[model samples]
Target: QMATETRTHGDYTVGWICASSIERRAAMAMLDELHEPLPTPEYDRNIYTLGSIGKHNVVIACPPMGTAAPYIISMTNIFRAINFSLLVGVGSGIPPDVRLGDVVVGTLEGHNPKEMMLNPLVEAENSVHVETWAATPPQPLLEALKKIKTEYELSGSRIPEYLERLKRDSPALASRYLKSDSLQDLLFDADYGHVTPDFANLSFIPREENDCRFCDKTMTVKRKPREMRVHYGLIASADREIKSAPLRDRLCRNFGGKVLCIDMDIARIKILFPSHYPCLVVRGICDYADSHKNMEWRDHAAIMAAAYAKDLLHEQDLQILEWLTPVDYGPRHRDFLRRWQPETGLWLLDSAEYKTWLSTKKQTLFCPGDIGSGKTILTSAVINDVKTRFQINPVVGIAYIYCDHRHKETQQIDELIASILKQLTQKLFSLPDCIRQMYEKHKYGQTRPSLNEILGVLHTIIGEYSRVFIIVDALDECPTSSGCRQTFLKELSNLQNQFGVNCFATSRLDPDIIAQFRTNSISLEIRENAKDVQLYVKRYMEQLPAFTELDQWQQETMLVKVLEHVDKRYDLA
Candidate 1:
């Protein structure tokens, strides 16, 4: 039940910027779920495919062949919540350590031809100082790189499995994506030229059809055959594509022979975007950056790059889940939700008031009932439903608090609000710098954040999301003697008024709690919920020993009696 139709620009977090149609197809093939196309601004020229890979909702797009600069900036604007950008495609591989179909993850260095001093660069061993623009992948991507390398070292890369899935899912594109045996990956000597024998005529035509068929085999560099591997290092970026072996080798030499690949897109992106814009360039080596370049390995290289990017994203999702937080209501929510009968909450889920709360902003749904009336259980169901519906979109934050009188000492106003902040912040790609700074400031002082400090962080963090749902279960259980409950309710009200955060709460029909929500929320009293009570009684009876062994009349009599007793107080648990 993916609600693709209702998705907006903010729903997407990962921007997969491709250079060619093959790369776009390869990216699409790697997606676990393909989302419907979202409407774009009329001025946006780039076409897009919305999809999901692991936990990330990715928006894949290919800029018009030679015009990537404008479209990439447009992509940044269009996908407003994009924290991670992946420049995925095929590029010319440098010699020695790189080969066709090998993937290159970039710690990109943007170079300008004018700024590079090539006059003294001819001393083959000497490193030349060039004024270059450099950008590293964000912290999360770098962490993912480390994790993936370790995993690959232990059990090998997942590329083969992903390729198999591609073959099974898209039969038509399988042959194209798969490596061809006939496409021999040849590396020529740096001095070898692909020009014909008539050297003085200045006719710049290749001797072979973009291959080394007519070239001397004795000049070829023999390499060992091995499985495709990922190489991480400096990737040089310039204004134009690299086609000459001498220039390619010189660029590599200038960088102390650390550049693994060369591409034309990365430089433009670095110049067009902000200095700190986080992006990782993944290039599959389609050809050696020499005279003999061809399209033979382009498809295979694109697929390899896409596969590596997908694996990195999966690792990133795992890292996000492991983010340390001060408070976690997940265990409490899970405990309560375990008692939920599958179809018992249909009445609330299908009700007009609940649907309205989900669709409208700054809305609240208050479920108040007597003690043991199943308010907490119904609250769990609502929390589960909200999570399921909005899980794919990272910008849609969902946080829940399960308050208990037993833990009133620990569940103070600040603690409850901090938990909400923790949940929402975890949904982001990285913690907001402001939140990080606040934590550091308090951490150094060895003091806890005051209620105002926590609320301030909460306000800032909530602004990062396009929408937020805050569910507080058993609100009446919060201590009222110290005005903790009042303060908590006021903060929720402020968040709702200022940020349009949706608020959902369940509690006993205490006069104070009822008065707080009476004017602003849609009230749903949980008492004598006949269908839920009947469903629970039937399920409980089925688990009993003699209930199923009895006749229909006896069963009916037992069921009626149980329902009658339970109907007075519908806790069901």
Candidate 2:
């Protein structure tokens, strides 16, 4: 039997799904006040407890215990009715460094359920299947977790206060399960096991009054406060308990040593929910999932997880989804930039012409250089400088493309335009109306825009910004045989002519590319500095072991030869 009245989806944006009664109770304890339970249909067996936490209507539920199937069913229905902005709950943890009540936040590497699964053949051979689920939580939730972690580290007493409050609320449960002293939190070697004696022999009976005496406290490992603090990494999720220490270590190693903890339920939630749904898993370490299982840390761990969740929800605006759709282009640009240090292009930064180009509008700078004359580094330096110069201006936008022959796909014209658009929109913090409309039209179908469509979008986005600067490096690396290189350069020229956009480009003196920009663009040839080259050759000759053993005349001859070769190469370029 179920109540006739149903709970409206608009009333609640956060859905907290707990695996056990203790976890559900822990979540409820964090709420400010409880609301009336809405009616559920007979077919829907979930028991929903509606509540409010800091102006947010939260619905908490605990599916039937002991199996994952019922929990999946409950979550499926819950998500269908409520578009949860936050989906999280307490889960079991299995990391040696993670203490009994410490929290572990999931990173991007930890959200792959497919990689965590055991192959059918391996499962058949072992007579068991390991469950590993991983999904990256939303960006906002991750940011909130980072803030809460900082506060916890600084205060050092929040967990104790939260425990005290829980004790006052439920005295009996606290006494039974949360009464262990800090010294009781011990770590045993993975190979160690509880001793089992022969029951058939009467001599095996213990003489002392204490419970079986096989446990050794001296074998425990010691840890510092920082070691027990909150951790952020990949979390392995599965339905069955991982009790073998060797297996746990193997899984951790197999996952590239990034798995900070293991959980039971997060994988199912990720597998069932839509990919766009915003969710985060915040779990406390209840057990090590080894031979040392106990009820002492269960209540305290649940409380800590719920307390952290409450802190995360506080003062957070639940209505905004600004951070939900993350842009991928930023990371790609950053990865390329990280290889070179800040001063790699110091020579280019010191140039007076480059300074003039930075302040000029509707100007095109074609920086032509030799293959190894450090053009790419100069382009990166120019991009960094432009970003710093216009960081405070909302009307200015900066975009860049680093072309490499090693990666052919990145040189595609559509990819180039898409990358530029992504950078501009990310800087603006919102997409232009035209780009948003195009995205909406194709997002559901997983269809990418054609080159012409992307060019139209880029044109619209450029018009939105008062001044836009585009830097394209290594134009010679783009596949000229496919005509993509020519087409892309033509678009840049068009942008400068039509929208008055400034273009900074680098190439290896390609005849076709030079012809396109030579008329109106400023051409700068990157030549090697003779004095710097001589200094480098001298340093190299001094460092060589053989040259150090040689006479002064021999060392001088080697330096002269190196300088002559460098001069010849520069002249050929």
Q: What number of clashing residue pairs does each candidate have, in the order they appear?
A: 0, 2
Deviation of model 2 at 216, angstroms? 2.2
Cα misplacement distance, residue 134 of candidate 1 (Å)? 4.2
lDDT of 2 by residue, 448-501 (tens): 668888788778878778899998888889877678888888888888889888
lDDT against the true structure, each candidate: 0.79, 0.64
Taking the tens digit of each residue's C-alpha lDDT, what string does model 1 give over 1-573? 143456778989899999878899999888877887888889888979998876678999887654567788888888999988888998889888898999998764344222364443246434333333445567877888888888688547657757765675678899888887877888889889764345523456543344566689788898889888899777776665556688788887777777788777766776677657777888999988777787778889999999899888877654433332445676677777888888897888999999999999999999988888888888889988998798656568999988888987768887788778877865654345566566567666666767788788788889888899999888888888678888889889999999999999988888878998879789988775778878888988898998999998999998998876764555644
Q: Which stretch of 10 consecutive residues in model 1 shows the poorest summed lDDT?
A: 124-133
What TM-score does each of the candidates earn? 0.52, 0.47
Top candidate (TM-score) = 1
Query: Model 1 off-target regions past 4 Å?
Result: 1-5, 108-134, 195-209, 320-573
